[model samples]
Target: MGVGLYLHFPFCQQKCNYCDFNSYAGMEHLLPKYLSAIKQELFLYKVHVSVVNSIYIGGGTPSLLAINDITTLFDSIRRNFYVADRAEVTMEVNPGSCTLEKLKVIKMNGVNRLSIGLQSFNNESLKKLGRIHTVEDFIRTYQYARQAGFDNINVDVIYGLPWQTGEEWQDTLAGVVELDPAHISLYSLTIEEGTPFGRELKAGKIKKIDEDLEAEMYENAVKLLKANGYEHYEISNFAKPGKRCLHNQIYWRNEEYVGIGAGATSYMGRVRYTNVKEIPLYIEKVFGNDYATAEKEALKLDKIIGETIMLNLRLLDGFRMDDLTKRFKTNIDQLYGPTIKVLSNQGLLKEEAGMLKLTDHGLMIANQVFQRFV
Candidate 1:
């Protein structure tokens, strides 16, 4: 398999309340320099990677770039990497940031998939989340993407908001199903320490929904999406048949990929590393030294096995013991048989037809199961 390439654009028009990513707001002044730094960073990886099968342009809203800048970015990628002809090229877009002209330009430059950030269909919820777009803006953007010839599209939604109700959650699912996007990603809200929601939670101004209610919301989403012909391929992702996000599958399968731009991570040659998070520092290091790695770790054999199991179990289909043995050249059962047996007896996991998978109950407390391997 060829290496997957991920490029991060860290600029957003306005940062959302719940975001704690490497993204920043009001960085428009640095756009030109940032793109230049990204191109330079891509060049530094040319000697290391020979073939790239997938290119994911994720961000702080990559659609916020200007027309010419987008074209230039793709041109630089082609210049530096041997991109496959049938590569899955995906770009993350926000509703208010994309226009019909911009979408057309993006398509013409070879982006075949788009992951739109439509966190909620309700205008009130959108406002509460500090989203810049409304229901109308999202609808218009989705329509524009379809008109621009993108058939494989993914819609991102979040459940478990501070004041969300079961009915409202169902309505969001129904609304997205009506749109019939090729894929859907469902995420439960997590209040990280530095985000606005986290502060509100700390101040006791906002409260998390009841744990039971959150689980019910997830269960309802699974049923509703499946009934609409979407496959629950991953724990948090649903897809129409043959439309799964290929780049993410690389990570889940514990394969190698290269990451570019500020705060991006790469797993190559059995070593994992992340780039510097600060934009100015990233630019300086990339231009001055041709690399901007901030931290790295070389994996030991046992560590690799543990991490591989942790990532693969996220797929609903699970991984085979035989496959694990073959990949790592070791006896899988000898290493983890006892833990598996214990988990199975507790009804948190099951093994059937040589495949090991999570039971329905296991999916709810997946973190606990993963902790066993860790």
Candidate 2:
């Protein structure tokens, strides 16, 4: 199988309160130099670039780049790698960062998909989350994307926000249904330890929504999106039929992928590697001037099996008995029999047609079920 490519753009107009991605708040001036560094890095691995089937440009805000910058970057990719003619090319954008003109330019440059971040539509919630766009911004951006000839798009929404009302949650879902994006990613809000939200939480200035309320909101989201014709393929992602994120499915399927840029991770064969988190150091290393890798770890068979189970279990189709056997060189029943039995007995999981899947109850208590694998 061909490896997917992920390029991280660690620059955003403003960092969100809950975000802990290696993205920076400002650094537009460094783009030219950064682009050069990325291209230089691409050149170094040019020989290993022939098997790419998908290229995802994710970010602090990839849409912050001028159309010309994106065009140049795409040109460099073509010059250095062999991308399939129908490769899924996706770019992540914040609603506040794009113009119709820029979007059109993006389409012309071979970007076939756009994942727009519209965390919430309610003005109060947007402010609370520190989003730069209003609901109107997301609406206009959707309109422009349609006009600019983009047929595939994913809109991201977050539930479980602090102080979010149930009514507000329903209203956001209603608004998203009206927009009718091809794909939707509904994520629960989590407070990572180093984020601003985390700090506020530790200081007791902010509160997490009650677990029961969070679950209710998530249930509401699933019902609303399904009624609007979205398929719940993964826990946090839904899509209109046949429009599920292909590149993402590659990860859920436990396939190999290569990551480029600061803090990006790559998993190929048995090797897992990440680039330096600092831009200057990343550039230096890419230019053969230093050896500053942020992290690298080689996996053994047990870790690989655990990781494969962890990732694949997130999908609706669940794990395959045959594939697990082949990959781990162990009988699936013999290795995980006890854990599987316990989960099945608890009605959290079941085996059907030779694949294991979560029951509706299991999906809610998924973390507990997954922990048994470790």
All candidates' TM-scores?
0.98, 0.96
Residue pair clashes in candidate 1:
none
Candidate 1 error regions (>4 Å): none
Worst 10 residues of 1 by lDDT: 348-357
Whole-model lDDT values for every prediction: 0.93, 0.86
Candidate 1: what lDDT? 0.93
lDDT of 2: 0.86
State the lDDT at 300 in candidate 2.
76
- Which pairs of residues clash in candidate 2, taking residues 3 or more apart in a chain or in different chains? none
How many angstroms is residue 247 displaced in model 1 relative to the true structure, after the best TM-score fit? Answer: 0.6
